[model samples]
Target: MRIALLSYSTKPRGGVVHTLALAEALAAAGQDVTVWTLGRGGDAGFFRPVDPAVRLRIVPFPDGPAGESVGERILRSIATLREHFDGTGYDIVHAQDCISANAVDSCVRTVHHIDHFTTPELAACHERALTTPYAHVCVSATVADELAAGWGLKAEVIPNGVAYERFADTDPAARDRWRRRLGRYVLTVGGIEPRKGSLDLLEAYALLRERLPGLQLVIAGGETLFDYRDYRTRWETRAAELRVRPLVLGEVPDDDLPALVAAAGAFAFPSVREGFGLAAMEALAAGVPLTVRDLPVLREVFGPAARYAATPEALAAELAAALTGDDPTRRTAGRTLAARHTWAEAARRHLAFYRCLG
Candidate 1:
């Protein structure tokens, strides 16, 4: 089968990561796979090297005019991708995000999670993406249920696959390097965005710091097309009020990410909304203690592998336990859980779905 997987950006966001991994896995299964994405900010390729078997079509999307609203950017993104993408020969045209789903004439969309957009263009685009697709997929049953309840659309639930070995097999020397540089730290990925519950994490870290004075808060990996300046400004003001200074590493090298995850004393995932907590799963694979927001999707995905918390106070308590307690059974369960989600299995299931569409 000739499959074309479409994504909105070349950055290392979770959806883009899923697109690349699934494409590679499909190619490995002897299917012809081509990935289509817009090269935002003049990017020529993906954040990491892709497997040679999978073909790439990177459409150049130069920066928009200064002072462009996010809604304007969304419209331009769809037009630009629509202008460049030719899904002529693919047996399965799968779109991974709103932009690509809106850009294409018809496709099978993977609704990683549902979002409520206020921007008129963005809201319209989001609605069209959800309503227009011939078939839909979700990374968790919780999200699939959302599609069913809100839109009355039934979607196939296929969980994401973590690069289990990449993290689990990280060298001890590499882990030690991060520890030497940062000391004992609690880490979270996905930047200081509202959805990530960045402000909540800040509050929790402040509370935790009172007891664990030596522990640090580290944040990494925030790449997105939307403007979060207003939310970020609010976060900064709140951080100042809380008197906590988190080491904000915007984006780390992909090669060093596993070691960084492995070195953390505790991994924090306080996201208010998520399709799947890929980064948290990576932490599990790295044998790091995990704590996440008390969301149904996360509960379904992490099960006994992670600690759950609902508020800043609860998050702080969970993080403290994750750092101080030695629950070897839970740790073992985490590693086994992460190892069970393989890209090969995800790919096989995706192929079966595509066949059913025929």
Candidate 2:
């Protein structure tokens, strides 16, 4: 099959990561797969090196004019990709996010997680992205259910595959390097955004600090298109008032990320809304103790492989346990579960889905 996978950016955002991995897996399965993405801010390549077997088409997207509204940027981004993307000759043109989904009609879409939008243009775009596609895919049953309930869309559930060996097989020497640098830290990826539950994590970290004075809060991998200055300002102010400092490593080197995850004393995933807890799953693959927010989606994804907390206070308590407690059984369970998900399997399922669409 000649397949084209579209994503909004060349960054390491979740959907982009999904697009690249799925394409490579498909290519390995003897499918002709090409990954397409908008190169925001003059980027020429992806955050990490992609498999050489999968073809890459990076569309150059220059920054919008000064004071350009997000709505305008959204419109421009869709127009730019649509104008350049030649989806012809592809058996399956799968869009991985709203921008790419809205860029073309008569395409299949992967609805990672549907969002609620307030801006008129954004709401309209979201609507089209949701309803325009002929068929849909989701990363989790929880997200598929939301599509069915909200829009009567029957999206096929294809769970995300982790880089199991990359994370699980992290070299002890590499892990020791990060441990030497950060010194017993609790880590979270995905930036300081509302959906990430950043404020909640901040509050929880503050409470945890009273007991674990030596433990640090380290954050990495924050690449997004949205403007979160207000939320970030608020987070910083609170962090100052609480007298807790978090090391915000904006984007860790791709080679170093697995080791960074492996070195952490515990991983905190306090996201309020998630299609699937891919980051937490990576932590599990690394055998790191985990504490996640008590969200239905996360519960469905992680099952009993992780600890959950509903409130900041509860989160603080759970995080403390993760730092100080010993649970070899849970560690073994997490690694086993992570091992069960493989991109090759996911690619075969995707092939079946595309064949079914015929």
Candidate 3:
């Protein structure tokens, strides 16, 4: 089968990662797959190197006019991608996010998560992306349920596949490097965005420090198309008020991420919204104890393999518990769960779904 997968940017966002991985897996399954994305900031390739089997078409997307609003940028992104993309001759055109879905005339969209945007242009874009797609996919059943409830759309649920072995078998020396550099710390990814519940995590980190004064909070990865400067400023102000210092390591190298996950004392995921907790799952693969927001999607995905919390106080308590002891059973369960989700299996299922659509 001939397939074309589209994503908005070449940055290391969840959807872009999914697009590249899925494309490679499809190619490995003896299918013709090509990935299409905008090379934002003159990026000629992905954050990490992609497999050679899958072809790439990275359209050069320059930065927009100075002082453009987020809503205006979204519209421009859609327009730019639409102008460069050619959906002809492909049996399937798959869009991985709202921008890509809006770019193509028709596509099979993977709705990673549903966002409630307040901006007029953003709200309309979100609506059109959900309503206009020919078919829909979601990474978790909870998100699919949300789609059904909000738009009366039935979607196929395809859970994300983790790089199980890569994380599970991290080099001890590399892990030692991270530990030597950062000491014992709680880690979170995805930056200081509102949806990531950054403020809540800051409060939780402050509370955790009362019990373990030496423990650090290390944050990594903050690449995104949307601007969150205001939210970040608020987070910084609150951190100052609480008298806590956090190490914000923006965008760790992809090659070093597994070892960083393995070295962490505990991983904290306080996102208010998520389709699937991929980073948390990676932590699980690395045998790192995890504490995440008590959301239905997380509960469904992690089950008994992780600790859950709803508030900052509860989150601090859970992190304390996670750091205090070693739960071999939970670690084993987490590794087993992570191992069960493989890219090969995901590719097989995707092929079946594509065939059914035909």
TM-score of 2: 0.99
Cα lDDT tens digits for candidate 2, 249-299: 998888999999999999999998899978889999999999999989989
Poorest stretch of ten by lDDT in candidate 1: 236-245
The order by descending lDDT is: 1, 3, 2
Give the runs in model 1 whose Cα sits over 4 Å from its true position: none
Worst 10 residues of 3 by lDDT: 11-20
What TM-score, computed on C-alpha atoms, does each candidate reach?
0.99, 0.99, 0.99
**lDDT of each residue in 1-358, candidate 1, tens digit only:** 9999999998889999999999999999999999999999999999999999999999999999998999999999999999999989889999999999999999999999999888999999999999999999999999999999999999999899999999999999999999999999999989889899999999999999998998999999999888999999999998899888899999899999999999999999999999998999999999999999999999999999999999999999999998989999999999999999999999999999999999
Clashes of each: 0, 0, 0
lDDT of each: 0.95, 0.92, 0.93
Candidate 1: residue 148 lDDT (0-100): 100
Maximum-lDDT candidate:
1
Q: Under the 3 Å rule for N, CA and C atoms, how many clashes does model 1 have?
A: 0
> Model 3, 232-257: lDDT tens per residue?
99999999999999999999999999
* Root-mean-square deviation per candidate: 0.6, 0.7, 0.7
Worst 10 residues of 2 by lDDT: 11-20
